[model samples]
Target: MKDAHSNRVLLLSLLIGFIVVSLFVLGVRTLVPPDEGRYAEMAREMFASGDWITTRLNGIKYFEKPPLQTWMNALSFTLFGVGDWQARLWTGLCGIIGVLLTGYAGARVYGPRVGLYAALVLGSSFYWVACSQINSLDMGLSGMMTIALCALLVAQRDSATPTEQRNWMLLCWAGMALAVLSKGLIGLVLPGGVLVFYTLAARDWQIWTRLHLGKGLLLFFAIAAPWFVLVGLQNPEQPHFFFIHEHFDRFLLKEHKREAAWWIFLALLAAGCVPWLGVLVQSLLQSLRRTPGAAQERFRPGLLLLVWVVFIIAFFTKSSSKLPGYILPVFPAVALMIAHYLETASRRSRSVNAALLVLLGAAFLGFVPFMLRLAKRAGEDLLYQQYQPWVLAAGIVALAGGVLALVFDRRLQRDRAVIALALGGFFATHLILAGFEPIGQARAGVGMVPAIRAEIMPTSTIYAVGLYEQSLTFYLGRPVVLVDYLDEFSFGLQQQPALAIPTVDAFVVQWRAHAAAGVRDIAITRDDIVAQLKKDGVPVRIVAADARRIVIANF
Candidate 1:
């Protein structure tokens, strides 16, 4: 009882500290581009335009994704009045919700101890914590999928009454609906695929009857169908671009250019799991064995979880588009599996987990010297230099945490070992990510924002030439004209031909004309463009210049 009480106190303290740090970091970093800036700016545009159905990025019709994130962000802005923290609130909440839901579900399905461990494992994992604060659609998608996954677990647990199963299954459906809105069809498709694989592998066809498909499907369509319908009606072209182009092409073709080596996510899982990386394979292997429960209880949760992890990894691996976060949906499952393993984990297993963190920290310390070589562009060497100490500090923290955890594990104070490792892993990732502000701020064009904001008149025509600094428009609270730039916006620009300047010649004509009319023309363009404009006597007065870009004015 005394040990339990002490552990509870430590857990509560860690929970409080984690929440405080998590909330504080959401606002600390400048919204990084292109993902952070792009999504936040989309929300800002939605909030400003009051058109929730048709999403736009930089004043172009953006149908690349659904509007769930945009709606949530726009609503956040409405309530909180448009700041970086407010923009991140939705994804942040999603992250928190996922943790709580996973914890609750694990407790209900497994045991209270396992539930607690699951939450601790997930909340501290580098990937989960990092994505939680980031203003990305991945977190939103992962969050909703978490709800779906956990609901299914609770609904299927052996102790659940028929009523409990039905209601939770309904929630499971609603979560899929929200997931669809959050990302796209994958919300439903991925879960549905997992169910199919689970049934075949476990040979539990009876699981089908318990899913409450009729009412669940009705509820799902009711929630998910409206947005796709409204958006399609508002812009008939959205369906083709979204359903066919975005989904099919992105998966089947290498045109998205996100393709990585097939082993990429395998590597990410190893790193992203952090301290748990040592136990990952063993936990998954443990799932391959039958877990103790009623012989009549045909719902094999371990099999289901194993299938979830394998299927998601396999599904994304087969796709030509591979990104780090594609496997994010598996973290919750992995955490649950790890927690179950830790319930009976030997001292050796615990020692290895602690040791991995130490090695990771040492690796970070080792890599500190190579940061200078990581700079792709000029002036970034300084940013890398600035980032080294943060990495060093993170390494030290992880090393210390691992050493402490090893000591506790050796002493057989299992709970303390886990808690110590959790704290260490959590802080190590947070420090490294937070320390990235210098580099993120530089990439985000935040330094230029104040200077750029001061020079802009109400009628100033802002044009992004050759490149779009995604976060720049978000910081300024306005969209810019696109000049000779149509990378992701090509489909949107094809539909709205008038939203962009089309070519440099056309932009130059407009800039020269605006100058004559006493209008301020601000063009944030490449250094080469600024140089050429000056060399060609094109009337560009440089306002601010950076190694990568130059903010100029027509005067």
Candidate 2:
């Protein structure tokens, strides 16, 4: 009867996970402010061209990022149709796998309850849900790194069995190789840093013996090196730019010019964890109070989780370039730690659970009003905007989930009720965000494409004068002409004269000349420049105008 009850609990957990993740995955689209549209479009181009060597954005050599992400999207596009869904499929799938792996690892190391909680927390994390529904590489890289960590943990746990340890070690190395393919050296560096720190801190030299270093190194090279060598051979000029300029210099010297103070990331970490921040703090505090023997036995995992979080935050904090997604890999460790805390809590700790539930409920309630204020401040017409309904719905669901948790806590055992409520809240939040939010944003971009297309002639050149909008480029299915604005783009334009305009004045002068010479059809926004052109006896037609950008054309 006990066994049957345990089996039933496991089944119930699985059902909840499946429902939550499936809802999160539903109606999802690759549309966000920055990376999603850019990366998704780039992948579409890669699929269309069948050339995987170089990535092109707006039809220029886009050597800024590696090709692994584009390759994944291309493969998916080939299998599925070229739509937002196909573009974002890999990221979402990777997220789901990462959550499952986190749960499985927790179950193996701790117990079934911990595993279920770990999976629930991870799947519902705001950062995880947001990154998973985009076309960016961070989530994919995070997933790979999580796999490597799990392998290492399993290997350590089974050190008595040399053969099993060896297999798990190989899995770790293989996962590291894929992590390299996903992002870069940080994949190996971050995890390696954690392991080294844990070993030294714990005084566990036996870990070195179990690693099988010689064979593991060979496996890593076999899986990861070939692609690097082949791609480097094809583009000899790429090595210095990619390795030194893009990776090392950008992080160390602020070459990218995106510098933020260290405390900013600390604040971001707090926000990223969301309503669970209260519980996370409690977990960390509890872990610090463990006894010596208990600490030693569990300290490796705890230390590893700590190092993962600290190193990622510190590394990016000191770097010149920082994005919220850069620290995504740290989330799994956070989830695991939180799971461990919840599972280890005594049944008598009802006060702790009650306090956490109240705090979470308060946070959820507070978020709704804050969001409305943000919408108003941004000058967005919430009722008319496509995303307004989705955001409002998410806010409503979050509030309801929070209220439900608080109410249910009074009617049942504090620990189980608290866990159930937390999980339910997260599930509701993730489902709303994944299913509705992204699609609304993506559709807005898609709607703009038609206006852009109507203005450009099939043969007339389309150029991004000051920026490269990847979404527009992908929808248009052509290489864009680029006008000079900055040094890098200026250099690129010099290399390709057809894409360059010498100066803004020169461009305006040429445009006027063309207009005088029977170019009667010209489209522009209703701006001061258009008014000036009209005043100067140049005919101009209004094309399209939006809160963000204006679409213009010349015939």
Candidate 3:
């Protein structure tokens, strides 16, 4: 009875700690550009327009991805009034769900201690923590995919009753459906491909019969098919662009323009698993010793996990378009595998973890001066200098935790040692991410918003020329008319020719007409364009200027 009470206390403490930490950090930093701002604006617009079926960006028809994330973001905006932290609620919640689900799955598969450790490992991993706090589609997709994968593993366990197995299978299908809604077809493709590979590799053809296919398919289509069908019917062009351009062409061609050498993902994995590298390497080696054989014939979850990791890496490696977060779906599996290994390992593994933590701490502390030089070289010395204290604090905390873990290991308190190291990792990673506030402030255009907002009323015509600040639309509380610029939104403009000015000369003509008509109009462009516009004899008043951009209004 006492042991159970202690276990409950531990679980409650961890849950509360995770929620508090996640909430505190959610609103502390500005949203980063490109992914964060773009997705958030999409959601903001969704809320503004109240059109949930068709996803639009800056009031232009955007069919690149599905609207699952946008829907949630819109819902969050409706409930929480559309601030930075509110915009990020879906992602943070998904991440939390992912961690808890991983722990639960781990507990069921390995044991309670292993489950808790797996959750801790995932929560502390650099990529996972950073992605969870930002407004990004990857976290939502990764979290849903993790749920789908973990559900499959739990359902396939031997101890489940026939009825329980059916229910678990339904959960798996629902997870995949939500995942598909989160990103696109890749969610389904990745998991289905991994399953096929596992089936063939393990020579487990009979396992197919165990899946409740009929009911599962009905459930999947019920959740995932409605949006695709509804959206496609409303926008005829969506079917072609989404399936072909977004999926096939994105993978087969270099059209998305995110091409990178194969080795980039390798670097990302190493950096993402920092402080756990040594333990993970040893765990993987230990995992390899238990191959699928007759001795352990009920099921080989480890082999399944290995196949999951290998297939995802290989699949994305072959794709022409790649990003660092594309491989996140594999992380939960990696955590589970590591936790499983840790559960059965000797005391030497704890020593290795402590050593890795010490190495990480020493590296951070020892290279402080060098990091400052690099920061200076990158022309971000001020931001880096301000960030230095947090970096040092993270290092000191990590070193302290490592030393504490070592002491606990000596006292034969394995769980305490593991928890100490896990807490160290969590704090260190969050500190580094929080230190990015200065960088985000400078680059994300949050500072420029208030000045620009004061100069232009809600009724004023605003044009973003030559460049797009991804966060500008959200901050301004409305869309900016794009002038002579179309990158990713080219398809939208092509479909609706009236939404943008096609050339600078065209914009000049419009500007003169608006000025003549006594209309208040603002244009945001690069500083060079402002100079050229003045030289070309256009009447303009500079409203605000940042280092990289200038906002001009017709005089």
Candidate 4:
């Protein structure tokens, strides 16, 4: 009993350490482009406008995705005040919850050791760490969907009482509703679809009787329906565009312009699992084996996890739209499976795995020269130069982790060995991220913020010409009038045409008019726009310039 209590106290300490590490890493770097900038600015706009239901970007009605994340971001802004880490608070919390839930659920279903190991594995995972620290919609979606999936697994397990099962299933339904709010239909579809496939594949037709669909549907609708109905009613174009264009067309066609081959997700998984790849594969194989009993009588979490992973991969592989983050939902399942395997692995097997991890880390160091050469070719040599030391440190740390794991295994302290490896992987992930901060700094246009902020006035109009560095608006604390550029904001601009200047010529005219009216306005553009304005004989003063863009004023 004393030993058990000591172990619990140690686990609690480790969990708290993980959360503190997550919080520290969250604020280590500036927000990165396109996704981070856009999402943060949307939240900023929502906070400024006090419009929680309608999501907008740069003062235009933006609806590329659902507003749940934006709403969370807005709320975060309200609570914490707007900043880089503040912007990432919600996603990071969701990620932390995901790690805790996976650990707790695994412990509940398997045993205490499996649960703790699962949380550690997931908390240290490369892709999961990176995504969780950024302001992306996918992490929030992944976290909520994980809850729904894990809740259902626990609720329907053989050991659950009828009351326990019903409560857990209701939590599953609530999670599904939040998932839908997170991204869209996939939250509910993916889990529900996986359950259907599992039922059919396992021939467990009686499992449907346990779903409690009537009340579950009510719970799902109660949570998910209000937002859809309100948004659709407020904007008539929402239902058609969101359901049809964003959902169906994105999946069925290449209109969104994001595409990758079917095998991309597989490659991602291989890269993502990195240090634990060999053991994860073995665990997956073990999961496929059934207990010695009637199929319906058995509750197979491994089989459920396997189906979940395969179905998500297959589903996205079939979609025309693909991104690396789409497959994040599978990582938690894989983590639990790997954790279970590691719980029972022999010391010999554990030692071998530790050695493999050491080799992988050492191998990472050898690629640094090639990566630097490629960066030089791409004109990012300075960025790569700063990045090398951080990468080297990460590699060394990982190697040390493996060495420590082996030492622990030799002492028959297997749990300590696993913890060493997990900690190594966790720190390695952050070191790599810290290395990439220089790159993000350059690419995210943060250096230009001070110059843009300097020339600000109440009546000043800002124009983004030919290109939009999404983070610029957030830093400048005001929306820029876009000139001759329409990308993701195109939908929002269509709803309110007055918000955008349709052409460079039109922008020049506006600039001249604003100048005539004694108004100072700035245009953020690329070098080509500068040349075009010079050739057109328009008066311009260069306020600031960076490698990627320039800020010019018409005076």
Candidate 5:
């Protein structure tokens, strides 16, 4: 009994440690561009402009994603201030909440020890932890989906009373609603599909009767509809583009250019699971059979988990729009299965997991040089060199963890072994992310921000000529005039042509006019554009420059 008590305390300690480190790391790195910077800037723009109805990036309408992440991020900015950590605050909380939610559900459905392990597994995972610190929609969506998943797990168990079932199902519906707001329709589609498939596969149609669907759907719509209605009412084109182009077309067509082999998710799952990957396949196999205690219950948690993971992976695998983050929502369900296996795993199995962690860590160390050589962009070699020591340290941490886990496993201390491996895995993830700061700093145009900030006047127009650096715009606290740069913003630009200069020739004419008027205007463009401008005899004084972009002014 004392040993069991000690184990529980130790698991709780590890869970707390994972969360503390997660929060601390939120402020450790500069925001990475494309997703992190793009989302952060949208929140910043919405916060600054106070036009929460329509979201804009660089002063152009951006409808690529639903606004839950942006809304939460904007709320964070409102409560705190606009900064890197502030931008990531929403995703971080979602991750932490997810861990807690999964843990609670596991305890309710499985056992207390299994619940703790589930939380530790999910909290320490590379995909979940990394996305948590990033200011992106993936973590936000996954977090909400987890709420739905866990709520259903707890509510549908034979152990749950009538009142508990009603309340938890309502919460489950609400979670799906917020999830829809997080990314898009998949938030509802994936979970609903999982339920349908689970029903068919389990051959338990009567389980549907217990779901309280009428009240649940009402709660779902109440939470999910207002924004869709308002956004669609104000902008008529949103309904088609968001529901059709973003969802259906994005799934069926190769226009996104994000297609990959059907097995891409399989690869990601293995890599993302890290130390836990050793037992992952076994866990999935184990889930195929009913649990020891669940035979009496009509609603099977193991079967539900199996269906959840398989349904999500298969759903994304079929979609042409494939990305690494698309597979994130499945990890929490994977964690629960792995946790159940770990609870009763043989000593030999535990030892093997420890040994795998050591090998993985050493292998990572061996790849450091190749990682350094992967700097494709010019001037990034130095940044990669700076990143080496962190990766080396991470490998060492992994090695240490494996050794400790091996020691604990040999002693027949299961939870201790598990905790040691989890700490090592999570800290290794934190180190790699923290180490990426040098690269992130460069990509975000960090050094040039100060120079550009100094050059800005209240009336000065900022132009993103043939380029747009999302983080740079956010840091400057100002919007830029789009000069012949339209990628993801193309749809938004189609509706508002006045927001951007259509061509470089047109931009050149405007630049000359501004120069003649003695009005200071800043333009961020590529080196080739700077050369072309100088060749064309357009007046442009270089103020600041980085590897990817140059900031120029008409003074």
Candidate 6:
């Protein structure tokens, strides 16, 4: 019966993990608010044009990012159809794998309870939840990093056994190779930081011999170097800007011109871990208070987790450019640390449950005013009308969950119940937030692109004046010629008969000259010489008009 009960608990934990992870995977969608659409469209354009070497947005050379992510999306499109969901599926699946691997690592180091909690925390994290649902490189990069970290831990744990150590070390190198493919040098940088720090602190120089550094280096180069060499050979001009400027200069100096103070990232990390912030803080404090012996035994894992989090924060803080998803690879370690805390607390104190309940209650209350503001901003009066009932429902769930946790604090079964309740509150709050207003706002601007495309001729030269919408370019499936009011925005504009005018007067002069030279059936913004032409008896047809500008095709 004891064995049977143990098996049942394991099955139940696995089942819960599956359900939670599935909720995260299935609930999130492709073409999320910002970067996903841009990346997906770039890949679509690349696949459509059959250009594997250089990434082109609307048929012009775009070298802002490497082609690896675009290549992944293109492959997905080839296997599946070229749609939002198919493009985002790669990231979503990677996120799921990351959650599982995190759980596996936790189970090995701590126990099944820790494993389950780690997966739960990660699956529910706002950052992971948001990033996984999009078509971006971060999810894949995070997965690769998590795999590498887990392999390193396994190798460290098995250092006394040479054969097991060798196997684990091989996995670590393999993971590092994949991580490089996912992002860049930071793959090696982050893991390398953790390993070095661990070795120095624990005074474990013997472990270095077990790592087989020569073999590992050769393997890493063998897997990750060829692609860089091939892609570089394919595009000779890529080296100076891509390698030195983008990778190094961006990090070391503020060349990209995106410097932020260190504390800003600390605030971002706190925000990214939302709802779990209180528990994570407690965990960090607890880890800090450990003695040297305890530190040596568990210090490597904790230090590794800390290093992963700190290095990313420091790296990005010092970088000339920054984005929210850049810090995502650190989330796995954060989740692991939080999971360990929760498991330890559950074993030792009932006060932990009390604290979690309080956090959930606060989170529930916090959403009410936030949702109202979001609804007002999005102009969704109907959501405001329906808001009270949803708020009440969420509050009820939170209260019920809190009461249940308080009532059954001593029961092991109640632990899962409390988790379910917390999950319910989180899901309910986000479901309302996601479904009601924010999504509508994100789609509002691009919603008219399809209509504009339909109104214009298939081969009609469309141009964006002083505006760039990558999503628009991707959906239009044709290069929207950019009339450059600026030179910086010229990279993504297609090669066509267009003038990159620096000023409105220059554009007006050029348009008149082109028209006089018998360039008939030209498309121009209504303000860009079309108005003057209309005054001069030049026939103009309004192709499409939006809140911002008008598209006029004239003869």
Instruction: Count the clashes in each prediction.
Output: 0, 0, 0, 0, 0, 0
Cα lDDT over the full model 6 = 0.64
Higher TM-score: candidate 1 or 3?
1
TM-scores, each model vs. reference:
0.97, 0.86, 0.96, 0.96, 0.97, 0.82
Query: Which pairs clash (backbone N, Cα, C closer than 3 Å) in model 1?
Result: none
CA lDDT of each prediction against the hidden true structure: 0.90, 0.66, 0.84, 0.86, 0.89, 0.64
Candidate 3 per-residue lDDT over residues 112-209, each given as its tens digit: 87788888888877778878998989999999998888888888876777887899889999999999999999889998998898888777787687
User: What's the residue-level lDDT of 534 in candidate 3?
Assistant: 94
TM-score of 1: 0.97
TM-score of candidate 2 on Cα atoms, chains taken together: 0.86
Q: What are the root-mean-square deviations of the candidates from the true structure over C-alphas? A: 1.5, 3.8, 2.1, 1.9, 1.5, 4.6
lDDT of 2: 0.66
On lDDT, who's better, 3 or 6? 3
Q: Write the per-residue lDDT of candidate 4 for residues 1-555, one digit (tens) a residue.
A: 233213868877888898998987787888888889999999999999998878888898987788889999999899989889988988999899999999888888887878888888888888888789988998999999889978988897889999988999999999999999999999889998999989887777877888889999999999999988998889988888788888899999998788987799999987787567658678888778774463655577888889999999999999999998899999999998898888777888788878987987897788676666756334588788888889888889889999999999898887788888888888888899888998888778888888877886888988999888787778777888888888887788888999998998888888889988989888889888899889998878999876788889887
Q: What residue runs in model 4 are displaced by over 4 Å at the alpha carbon?
A: 1-6, 292-296, 369-371, 376-379
Best by lDDT: 1
Tens-digit lDDT track of model 1 for 1-555: 245323667668766777778888899789999899999999999999999889999989999899999999999999989998998999888888888888888888888878888888998999999999899999999999999999999999878899999999999999999999999999988999999999999898889999999999999999999989988998999999899998999999999899899888888888788878989999999988887655677677888899999999999999999988898999999999998899899999999989988898898899999989989887999999999999999999999989999999988988778878888888988899988998998888888988898899999989999999999889988999999998999999999989998899899988999999999979999988887888878998888877767999998
Q: What is the alpha-carbon RMSD of candidate 2 to the true structure?
A: 3.8
Clashing pairs in 6: none
* Total clashes for model 2: 0
Expressed as tens digits, the lDDT of each residue in 1-555 for candidate 5 is 244324657656766776788787899888888788899999998998898878888888888789999999999999999888999989999999998898888888888888878887887777777888888888899999999999999989988999999999999999999999999999999999999999998888987888899999999999999999999989998888899989999999999899999999999998888778888998999988887765677888888999999999999999989999999899889999999999999988888878999998898799898886888888899999999999999999998998999999998888778878888888888898999999999999988988988987887899999888888888788788898888898899999989999999999898889889878889999999999899988898999987889999998
Off by over 4 Å in 6: 1-34, 159-161, 288-299, 346-414, 425-433, 436-444, 485-555
TM-score of the candidate numbered 3? Answer: 0.96
